[model samples]
Target: MKKENLIFGIYPVIEALKSETDLDKVYIQKGIENPKIDSIVKQIESLNITINFVPIEKLDRLTRSNHQGIVAITSPIAFHSLETIVEEVLASNTLPLFLVLDQISDVRNFGAILRTAECTGVHAVIVQKKGGAPVSGDTVKASAGAIFNIPICKVDHIKDAIFYLQGSGIRTIAATEKTKNSIYTTNLNQGIAIIMGSEGKGVSNSVLNLVDEKAALPLLGEINSLNVSVASGVFLYETVRQRTQ
Candidate 1:
């Protein structure tokens, strides 16, 4: 974590939240009771920022300075809104190609996907605010600075984002082994959004139900599944190939 990316102390964190700063996550000391802490909790809840309760020892490990039982990590890049990005893409007269990440918690995987998306000319990447990986220095490095080049929208839920994409005439596709359709068979030249699930769990049942199509990469070897990043690259490049041909 970079020093510039972290804002510690209770009052400072509260002010940052009030000022609408782009915070990745907030860490609060567990079992701490104070008026200011309560106020901060209320504001964070209202803002829908991800918060974690940790022990004093954990806080001590994070910083030696007086943290006042709270620390907020800021995102390196400001998140884009799904609706705004969609509107802009529509106005641009180009096919809308979006990548929706479902609970991809690994920073490296997230960064790798962003790199692939950028190389493939994806219009935007959408992720759920709570479960997705934070945009940190590690992620920026893993992305080969491609994270800065692409637009990332952090929504409250993946399912809602799928609904919005479908309503906007964008076909939503899920990449999972559970599906019978192969990526090679799917038409990706049209406006589409691809949903890639987390490493541990495939796409959530809720999101899978809403997607317009389900496509999977053929795996003939012993491995049951490819890494999420690799799968995303395959899907993104296939879309590029389709559009180009």
Candidate 2:
């Protein structure tokens, strides 16, 4: 077993833990009771394998092969520190513009938003380590390959990111329908970070509270909301317009 490879079944996972292969994470079937399994769990805990107790059906679905009521998914991407990315941007000569997505799960929307962010000269796109969609091939294609060029940093918390950006002299703006202030009225000429939430649910409460300004797109039609990606483009390009002015 290798650190990069996935090892299924309780025994294999236990053996991997005993050996040199670092266990990234483990998924065990919830409500399972077995003495051998208990011993395996102790070893996994000692090795610091991030354990997730999931339904038995999930383990079955992931593999037709015998999973022994447990599975482990190998780590895909090495996480980049939010502080490091922001520092790198601030250390550079140019002003910074960042896009922070809160629980944005749709790959298409993520891709389109990234495309817009990159085109609008945003320095980086930050997202939570979990819940958000991965930078998959489809996302890259949807972004028209902008994913390769634009820097993306995964953080533990969105609020922390907002605070960090503000400390670095970057304003945090939230795009929400709940706000009456129009995006047009907000000054995006300064270094700033725009936070956009998912399609159904807007910005998380934690992030909403941290935004320096909560702005909305002026909508005259009956529709209550615009597509998240479309709305993001409006907000991002607005910054471009203000900067160009």
lDDT (Cα, tens digit) per residue for candidate 1, span 75-124: 78988888999999999999999999998988899899999999999999
TM-score of each: 0.82, 0.71
lDDT of 2 at 233: 95
The number of the candidate with the highest lDDT is 1
- For candidate 2, the clash count comes to 0
Model 1 CA lDDT for position 119? 94
TM-score of 1: 0.82
Clashing pairs in 2: none
Best by TM-score: 1
Which tens-of-lDDT digit does each residue in 53-162 have in candidate 2? 99999877777679888887664334466788888888896767899999888889989998998898888899876667655556767898888778888777788888
TM-score, prediction 2: 0.71
Where model 1 places Cα greater than 4 Å from the true spot, the runs are 1-6, 17-20, 24-71
